[model samples]
Structures are given as structure tokens and as C-alpha cells.
Target: MYKKSKIALAIGLSVGLATTAGAAETNWRMATPWSGGPWLERDAQMFADHVNDLSGGEIEIEIFPGGTLGSALKVTNSVKSGVADISHNYINYDYGTDPTTALLAGHSSGLTPEEFMMWMYQGGGVELYEEYRRDMFDVVAFPCAILGTEIFLHSNKRVETLEDFQGLRLRTSGAWSELASRLGASTVVMSGGDIYSALERGVIDAAEWGSPEMNRPTGFQEVAQYVIVPGVHQSGGFLECQVNEEVWTGLSEDEQDNLRLAGKLSVFESWLASSYDDLDAYEELVSGENEIVHLDQDFIDTIYEETAKWEDEYAEDNEWFARVLESQRDFKETMSAWPEYRLPIGTMGR
Candidate 1:
């Protein structure tokens, strides 16, 4: 009787797999926090297109740009609850789920986006991410978009030194906010959608949204006159696409492979597009109306010093955070050496 039961269970599993295989197509709903901004939004669209093409229309992803379904910050929950099958969103917004998320969600890790991607793809970063995700959230993840280093701060008033940050009300989030608070700035957390009105109403004296390309469409320049370069707070980061675990597991192997490939393609596409967009947007800011301010090197050095201190303290208290942090530090130490000796392409005029 026990052997019969085992055979019956195996047959049931085979039937379920066969039924799933026989399905003609699968439709998925994808949501994003942004209002379909050019960079991230474009990447999402391309990813969807790639999946469709690769799977021969076996998988169709309908994107809901902006917080049309719910608050942007609620994306992870939305996916978990099956309200949306997937989310193309920033991990920093989900740091509440697990503080270790900051390790990937734009900590001041001193690695540029390219370097971070290298660590993620080749140096065990993705494995670390998957371990954390399994513990903290029920979703399958992929790094769908990668951004260049951002313009650090945008202020209504000119800010050039560490002294300028003291008592300043800055709108930010994640690790950067923590670092800024330690540097004597008051940090306020708000959605990117809320920043404009807040800036106009004096709710925040300064903000650090994203790259100039991402910010230009929001009209930050209309209100903030000073634009600080080289985002020391967030050297580089990725926008991830996370799918519900059930939905991800339900897909066939080929379908799963297509999604993975699409995500990787999106990363490469976003990187290339952002380079051009950032260059043009930055030139416009510098030559146009706003006062372009470069942060003092000494002040930046101090910010890094403080960032290191925070990392040490946090790692001591949080094992997961330390695990990811130590791995990245180990990878970056040797990786950084290559760029230092190579051609000065990255340091030509800067």
C-alpha cells in the first residue's frame, strides 16, 4: 500500500507538470514605483519585449508604470500577496524587510555600477542576494537595471563643504540618509513623487533623487539651484525585478531562462542608455541655469571615513549585513587594483 501511494504521488506530479507544459502561454502583470521615467521605464519595456521575443509569445508581461496599483513603497508586499506577479523596483525602498538590503541597494560601497555588476555576476553577489531574499522576502530576483554614479545632492541653497550640511534638512533614504544624519544633516524620508512639492514648500532644503537624466523630467532644476556632482552617498546601484515565487516556480525551464536573459539584457541596455542620457543632462545643467557645485575633496574624504565607521558598527551588530559587506569588501579590494593600473579612461579629465 505504501509503494502504491508513492507511485500515485509520482503520477500526480507528472500530470501537474504535463498540464503546465501544455498551457499555450502565461501572462504576468509587472509593476514599478516610477511613473515610467525614461531610463528605468525604458529598460522595463525592453525586458518585456525580449521575453516575448525569446519565448515566442509564450510569456507576456503587461507593465503598470507608476504607483497605479498601490504605493511604490509597497511593491514587495504587492508581489508577495499576489496582487502583482512582479515588481521592477528599487531594493532600498524595501530595506525595512531586511537592513542587509542596503548592501546592494546603494550603500556607499566605493564601487561604481560596473564594479558592482562584476561582483554580482562573477563574484558571488547574486548568491548572497538570493540567500538574503529567501530569508526576508518570498520572491525570485534579478538585477534588471544598473545606473551610473549619481549627482550627490541638489540644494535650493549652495552647499560646498561639510559645514554646509550641518542642520540642513535633506530628503533622502537608506544608508545615505544614515550617513547624512551622522554628518549633522536632518534627513527626511519621502517618495520621489513627493519631493517636488516638498522642496517648493520648504519641507526639505535639499534632495538626492538620482542621476540628472532621471531628475530632469521631474523639474528639480526649477526649484533647486545648486547641483552637487559625484554622488558619494550612492556611488552606484541597481533596479531589480522580483517575481512572485509561486509564479516563478510555475514557469517551465525555458520560460525561466528567457526571463533571466531578458533581465540581463535590460541591465546592459540601461547602462548604455544612461551613459548618454547622463552626459547630456549633466551638460544641460552645467551650461544652463543652475549653479554646478563640486563637493570639496576633503569633505568627501570625511564622508567616506564616517561611512566606514558606520559599516563597522553595523556589521558588528548584524551578521547578515556583515556577511554581504565582508564579501563585497573582499571582492572590491582586488578588483579596485586593476582600474588603478589600467588606462586613465575613467579619470581622464575629472
Candidate 2:
């Protein structure tokens, strides 16, 4: 009888230990607005995986693709409201909440991918982002991914010159919609999922989705004949990971550091992967049926002029907009010496 009682006590201790171990592991739901196959979705999964590894299995994040947890545009709100513990999303998706948010996501003829990274890590952009989101939405955000320039437009009709934009119906979002309207194009706002159908049915004449690799999986090539290049509107931008404030505050210092490091690593990985894949995807598109169109230098120059005007006008109204815009412009000016000092003439082969 004594031996049996000892054995039972040992079993009870084992069960208690197991329960405590399980309790120590933190599980989080990560929501994203991207569909399953794109690099954007891959970045989300990669960040989650990295977090799990970095935290040594203490943090486990499960990703819910677009529309699984909530509407694509509302995933950030889902994180804010605790429907999702975290979210991977473009910062501009929250443009309706504050127009300044769009600047963080990139703008027409804005920062290049490399310069944007410089501004983010070196120029205090990250701190500004954290402050802005925390004050406005009660969530914590980190830049988890960075994408190369997007395709300017995939169109059913040809757009060879500046005049071609006049009266054209275009599907776009955020500040680009306003910029497109300014250029005499009628702007239509819709989710990424709806763009293909709208173009197919003649509801919209053109749309700008993402980079070459990101757009390939959507099969825009099947329905759109003209693929415009030099995506001036969104030269490059960062995608962010937003964490619920309560959940973030609950994490240990080590766990929080792990999450931040994971985000930084994911950004580095995404830049290389997306840039390489874009090259392959661009090659494939050129070989396919779609006609590749490059915007003329004059057209691009005009866009740059209009963008500066629009930004200055916008800055005059909103305080945050003015602040962030000034930071970006200062960064641009500080880095303006790069071409003269670091690059050889023509910026060609080494």
C-alpha cells in the first residue's frame, strides 16, 4: 500500500509539471490582409516562424490569411480590438484613420527601398511610427517587411503618354487615388481581391496592385494587356506587424526583443527575396502576351513636380503630416550627396 501511494504521488507531480510548461508558452493569432500565395503572405509566415524560433518555442503565432479573421482593410483594427493578437499589414491601409499614415507606407515618387530603410532604422522613423500608432490606435507596430517598387498600372487600354491618363478609370487606393484624380484619371477604390474582376468586366480600365512578383500570382497578365512600369506612386514601402497593446505589455523583455529582432530579420529577408523574384517575374511577363510599357522621362518628371506640390499643400493642413513629411525631406536632402560621392558616372557597371 505504501509503494502504490508513492507511485501515485509521482504521477501527480508529472502532470503538474506538464501543465506549468504549457502555461509558459504564449500563443498568438496573427492576421494578414494578403492572400496565401504572395510574397506578402510569405513574409508574415516567415516573421511568425522566426518569432517562434527566436523565442525558443515560448511564442507561437498562427497566421490567418486575408478575410479569415476580418476584412483585409480592417486587420489592423482586428489587432487593436483583440480579435487578433497581431497583424501583418500595409501601413496605408489605415489611411482613412489618418492621412499621415500613408506617408509611412510610401508616396508618389517617395523614398526608394534602401533610403526608406535608412530612414526607418537610422532616421527615427520607427520611433515616430510607434508613437503615432500608440496614440491613434492603441496598438504597437514594427516594420516587418519591405517591398520593392510596385507596377504602376496593369491596363486593358494603352497608356503611352501623359495625355493617356485623361478620363481613364483607374483602381487604386490611399493617396495614389487622389494623385490619380489630379492627373485626370477617375479613381476607383476596391480591395486587392476585386481588382482583377473589375478590370475584366470593364468596371475599371486600369489598376496598380503590387510589384511584378507579387502581381504574377494574381494572374493579371491574363486580363490586362498593358503592364506599365516605374511604379512612381509607391517606389517602395514597409509592411508592418501590429501587436495588441495589452498583449505586448504582458511579454517579458526577452520575448519583446525576440519579436522586434524577428521583424528586422524578416525585413532584410523580404527585400532580397522580393527583389530577386521581381526580376524573374518581369522576365516572364515580357516573354508572355502582355505588352510592357515604360513611362516617358517627361511623364515621370511631371509626376515628381505634382507630388511635391500635393505634399506641401497636404502638410499645411495636418500637424503629423507636416512633421513626418519634413523628416523624409530632411533625410532625402542629407542623402542627396550619395550619387555624387558614392556612385560612378552613369550609375552603371562597377
What's the lDDT for residue 217 in model 1?
89
lDDT of 2 at 41: 55
For residues 28-101, what per-residue lDDT tens digits would candidate 1 score against the true structure?
A: 88878877576445777766666665655556788887677677777888888788898788888888766788
Q: After superposition, how far is residue 196 of candidate 2 from its true place, in Å?
A: 1.8
Error of 2 at 235 (Å): 0.3
Clashing pairs in 1: none
Candidate 1: segments with Cα more than 4 A from true spot: 1-23, 346-350
In TM-score terms, candidate 2 sits at 0.90
What TM-score would each prediction reach against the true structure? 0.90, 0.90
Q: Report RMSD (Å) for each prediction in the order shown.
A: 8.7, 8.8
The Cα local distance difference test for each model comes to: 0.79, 0.83
lDDT of 2 by residue, 1-350 (tens): 00112322353244323333454777899888877665445688778767765655566788888888888888888998899999898889889888888889888856888889999999989889888888888999989999789999999988867899889999999988988888889999988788889989999999998899889988888899999988998998999999999999987665666677778878887887888889899999999989999988888888888888889998999989898999999999999898786865335773
